[model samples]
Every structure is written in structure tokens, then in C-alpha cells.
Target: MSLFLIAGIALTGFLAAGLGTMVGLGGGVFVVPILAVVLGVELKAAIAASAVCVVLNSLRGSSVYLQRGLVNVKLAMVLQVSTAVAAIVGGLIVIFAPVQILKLLFAATLALTIGVMIARPNGGKRVKSGPDPYGLRASFDRPDDRGPAEYVPQHVRSGIGLSSVAGLTSGMLGIGGGAVQVPIMNTVMAVPLRAAVATSTFMVGITATVSALIYAGAGLVDVAVTVPAMAGIVVGAQMGGQLGSHVPVKMLRTLLIAVLLGLTIAMAADGLGFL
Candidate 1:
């Protein structure tokens, strides 16, 4: 039974990684829920594995985007420092919170994701997609064969705010928050939508790693859940990232909203002892 459960988890990890890479988001949203459902993992344990898998998926997904010249490293570096610091604090918060309460909060956030998705429309937007917005400009070639790319900022402070929020969310939840950060960069910060999406992939590892170590230290992580899940997630992210350039990113974003909402309700159920 353990072997069968392990295999099932491995498969789910693959699916999560694929979906995450396709959307330029980390796979934690996918990994965490599956661990809860199939593996009967406690929310805390699932969150730990989610953090680890997100880091692994980010390593694979971001590496590909970087190689293709889609990642904006300067932006990643600047945001990562603050995001990482915040993440450690955030992870500690999770450790101390009542497990039932944490579950409820996670559920609420899932509902928020749905609202964000429906409210925002992604298409043509011009914004700064950089970590250093204080007179720094970043230009890169598009990986998906769009063409050359360049971004100018209209709202730098807003971008920083969003990235900071991403950091907070990443720590509060066991997930990378590229979905939230990417859109804010594209829409509010006036970053080119495509560029923001591509570059957002790089932030996952930095954010997840910050919290994962704390979880590991707290003895909240279960290797039975983390090890195999991360292995599959890394491999799946690579494969999905290769396919990413082909799919419609907007569609994936829409799908991601529904998926996040469904998972949220399920998580709430788990909290209420329904699961």
C-alpha cells in the first residue's frame, strides 16, 4: 500500500509540475492539495512538501526560461532578498498558528484567487518587468519566438508592493506566488504581460527555499511525501516548460484560478474534518 501510495503521489507531482510550468507559476498549488487528498497528509506536512516541490519545480522551470533568455535575473535578485527574509518570518507564523485556523486561512485565500482571475483581463499591457525599478531598465529576447523585448516602468512602487505581497503570500501559504506577482507587474506596473509571465518563474525557488528550511527544521516535513514528490515535480516541470512556449498563457491562467478555488474548498473541508 505504501508503494502504491508513493507511485500515486509521484504521478500527481508530475501533473502539478506540468501545470505550473505551463502557467509560469510554481507547482505548489498543485502539489499541496494532492498530498492532502491522496496521501492523507496533514495540512502542515502537506505544506512542507509543497514548499519543497515548488523549489524543485522552480529550479527546473526557471532554468529553462533563463536559458531561453526569458528570465530577468536582475529583477529576480532584487526581489528575492526581501522576499526571502519575509518568507522565513512567514514560515514561522505557519508553525505557530493553530492547525485548524491555518487550514481555514488557506481556504479563504483559494477563494480570493478565483476572484482575482475573473476580475483581471490579460492581453496587451505595458509595464516595467524588473526587480530594480529605480532607474533600471531590462531588455531581453523572448523565448517563445515573439521577438525582442523591452519594458519601461510607469509605476515602480506598485511593482515592489506586489512582489513584496508575493513574498508574504509565499511564506503564509506553502506556495510560490508568481500568479499574483506576474499580473501585478504586467497590469499595474505596466510590465509587458509576456515578459512578466516569463520572468516570474525565477522567484519561486528563492521564496520557497526560505520557508522550506524552516519547515524542515521544525520537523514538519515528511520525506515520505517530499522526496518522491519533488523528484517527479522537477522532471515534470522541465517537460512542461518545454511545452510552455506553445500554449496560450492566458488560458492557463484562467484554468489556474478554478483549480486554486477547488483546492481551497477541499482544504477547508480537510480543516473541518470532512476529509
Candidate 2:
């Protein structure tokens, strides 16, 4: 690629990573669409490049969440087991799936994500305060004056089921499964939105790493593209992590919903050949 083209790719990666990390999704959702639709890259190559960026963004963003005690480690560990295994399966399937089918799937996934966000706009207000049977209990200080919030996770089995789906999407689309995981964690599992976002960020790194390895083994990833993008993603993720830590939960949800809405439009346009 020409120097100017490489610079443009890096800038795109930076913006994608910043927004993705802010919402705990990693940069894959934005990067894949931009690469395939805007930059004229093939779908499979875009996915491979996105997988690399997701891994890099997750690593940088999760580190900040970890330091702030926002991540639920036990919960993340439990979910990662299912997500990692399912991700490999998804990666294998995507290798053979037609580009048109993938585009439709991506659009469908975005639409579903928007619906989920709308259904639980307040992040499940029925917070239960009790001891946890699943041992996933955790607490964190809120950005508001309400002090620290403590709660135990509910519907553990359901969360695991959803996590598998998230992993599958992550592997297939080369995006972190945060759009699926975060909503399920908050709405179905009764996790606080901030905690859910942090935990999702932590889990996506592992999920993306597994998928990226599978893509790499298949000789799908292009280092020329991945290396420059990764550099920008690392910087962007750090900035986003810092911003996320200070943002209020309500504001964070609003931002997430807005971003999802835009992504849905973009994906639908591309899938329907309007882009």
C-alpha cells in the first residue's frame, strides 16, 4: 500500500479503537466495515485485520479496567470458557462462508443488538442484593453520589449460553462479542452496566486472541495491515479506557446505544447493497 493509504488505515483504526473500547466492544465492529466497505478490501481480509485490532484494543482497554477494580474476574473466567471454545468453531465456519451471507449476518446481528439495548435501557433496574450461589458477587464505586454498588450475578446459566453466542459472532466477524455479552450480562445476569462493560472488555481479549490465532494459522492475516493498525489501536484504547472509567453508567449506556444505532445503519446499508 502507498504511504498515504497506510496512514488512512491507521487513522481509521485509531477512531475505531477509541469508540470500541469506550463501549467495551474492541475495534473490530468498526474496522471490518470500514476496511471492507470503504477501503475496498475483501471481506475475509478485513475480518483477519479486524481480529488483530480487536486483540490489541482489548488488551489495552482491559488493563485500565483491571487496575480500577471494575472487572469481575470470576464471572469473566466462567464466561471465557464457553466463549473461547465457541470462537474457534466460528472462525472455522467464517473461512468458508460466502461474503454476501456474512454481510447479511452482520447486519442482522447489529439490528438485534440495537433491540437488546432498547429493551433494557436502564440496565435492569431490579437489582437483587443477596449472597451469590455462583460466587460471582462483586462491587464497584459508582461515578455518582450513590457510593459503592454491590450485587450478585443472576441467571448464570443464561449468561453462559449468551456468551457462547457472543464468542461465535466474535470469531465469525472478527469483532469482540461485547455488543452481545454486555447486554446479556447487564439485562439477563443482573450485572451493573459498568461492571459488565469492564468484564466484557477483559473477556474479549481472550476470545479475540483465540480467533486471531486460528486466522493466523490459516494464513489470513496480513502483517502489513495489522501492524500499523495495532499501533494506533493501542494508543486509542488507552485513551478510551481512561474516559470509560470516569464516565457515569447512564451516560455510558446512552453512548453505547447511539453508537450501535449508527453501526446498524452502516451494516444494513452495506448488506442491502445501498452502500
Candidate 3:
């Protein structure tokens, strides 16, 4: 590609990653569509490039969340096991799945994500007193200095089931799995939205790492496309992590819903051969 074209791609990657990180979607939601539809890249190639960006965004974003003590390490670790295994299966399926079908799946997933965000726009604020019997306790300091908050995760089994689905989508679509994970963690598991985002960021790195390896081994990844995109994603993820820490939960939810709605429309159009 020409220097100017490369620069434009990098800029797009930066914007995608920034938005994805802020909303905990990991940028693949934007990156894959732009690459495949706008840039005219092949679907598999676009997915591989998006997977690399997802990994970079997750690493940078998760580190920031960890430092703030927003991540639930134990819960993340438990969830990663399911996500990682399912991601490998998803990667294998993508090798043979039709591009049109994948596009439809992406659209459907985004639509579901929008519904989940709308249903639970606010992070659940009611905290049960006393220690959790399941030992899924997590604590984080509030941005407004209202003192630290603590909550126990409920519905562990359901969370794991959702994580597996998230992993499959992440591997097949090159998303970070946060779109599914964050809502489930917040709405079903009773974790706060920020905490859910943080935990999802951490787990998605592991999920994407497994899928990226599969794509790399199959020679699906285009290094020329992935490298610059990753460079931009790293910077954007840092900026997003910082910004997310300060933004209100309601605003973040609104941003996520809006983005998902837009992506849903684009993916559906593309799947129906209208784009």
C-alpha cells in the first residue's frame, strides 16, 4: 500500500480501538467491518487483522484496569478456561464457513448485544450484605471518592456458559468477546459495569491469543495490515482506558448501545449483499 493509504488505515484502527476499548467491545466490531466492506479486504483476512487488534487492545486496556483494581482476576481466570477452549473451535469453523454466513452471524450478535445493553443500561447498584458464599467477591474504588465498593458475583454457571459463546464469537468474528461478556457479568452476575468491562478485557486477551495463533498458523494473517493496525490500537486502547475510568456508567452504556446499533445495520446490509 502507498504511504498515505497506510496512514489512513492506521488512523482508522486508532479510532476503532479507542471506541472499542471505551465500551469494552475490543474494536473488532468496527475493524472487521471497515476492512472487509470499506477497504475491500477478504473476510478471512479482515478477521485475522481484527483479531490482532483485539489482542493489542485487550492487553493495554486490561493493564490499566488492573492497576485501578477494577479487574476480578479470579473470575477472569475461571472464565478464560471456557473462552479459550471455545475460541479454538470457532477458529476452525471460520476456516470453512461462508463469508456471507459469517456476516449474518456478526449482525445477529450485534443485535443481541444492543438488546442486552438497553435492558440493563445501568450497572446494578444493590449490594448484598456479607461475604459471598460462592467466593466471587470483588472490590473497586469509586471515581467520585464515595469509598470502595464490593459485590459478589451470582450465577457462576450461567456466566461460564455465556463465556463459551463469547469465545466462539470472538474467534469466528475476531471480536474480543466483551460484547457478550460484559452484559452477562453485569446483568446476570451482579458485577458492576466497570468491573465487568475490566474483567472482560483481561479474559479477552487470552481468548484472542488462542484464536490469533490458529489464524497465524494457517497463514491467514496479513502482517502488513496487522502491524500498523496493532500499533494504532495500542495507543488508542491506552487513551480509551484512561477515558473509561472517568466516564459515567450511564454514558458508557449509551455509547455502547449506539455503536452496536450502527454495526448491526452495517453488518446486516453487508450480509444481504446491499453494501
The candidate that wins on TM-score is 3
Clashing pairs in 1: 75-131, 126-190, 127-190, 127-191, 128-190, 128-191
The models' CA-based lDDT, in order, is 0.75, 0.81, 0.81
Q: Which residue pairs collide, candidate 2?
A: none
TM-score of each: 0.84, 0.84, 0.86
Model 2, C-alpha of 115: deviation from truth (Å)? 3.5
Q: Which lDDT value does model 1 have at 119?
A: 72
Give the residue spans of candidate 3 off by over 4 A.
22-24, 117-134, 239-263
lDDT of 2 by residue, 1-275 (tens): 88886777787788777766665556777777777777777778778888877877677668888998899999999999999999999899778877878887877776776676566555666355765777887888777868888888888988898899999999998988888888889888889888998899889889989999999998889877787778778777777767867767567667767866776777677777887
Which of the two, 1 or 3, has more lDDT? 3
Instruction: Return the clash pairs for model 3, or none.
Output: none
Best-to-worst lDDT order: 3, 2, 1
Write model 3 residue lDDT over 1-275, tens digit each, in one string.
Answer: 67775676677688787776665556777777777777777888888988888887777777788999999999998778898999999998778788899889888877876776566566555475665766778789999999988888887888888889999999998888787888778877888888898899888888999999999999999887888778777777778767877878577778767766887888889999998
Q: Which residue runs of candidate 2 sit more than 4 Å off their true CA positions?
A: 20-25, 116-120, 126-131, 143-147, 238-275
Q: Which scores better on lDDT, 1 or 2?
A: 2
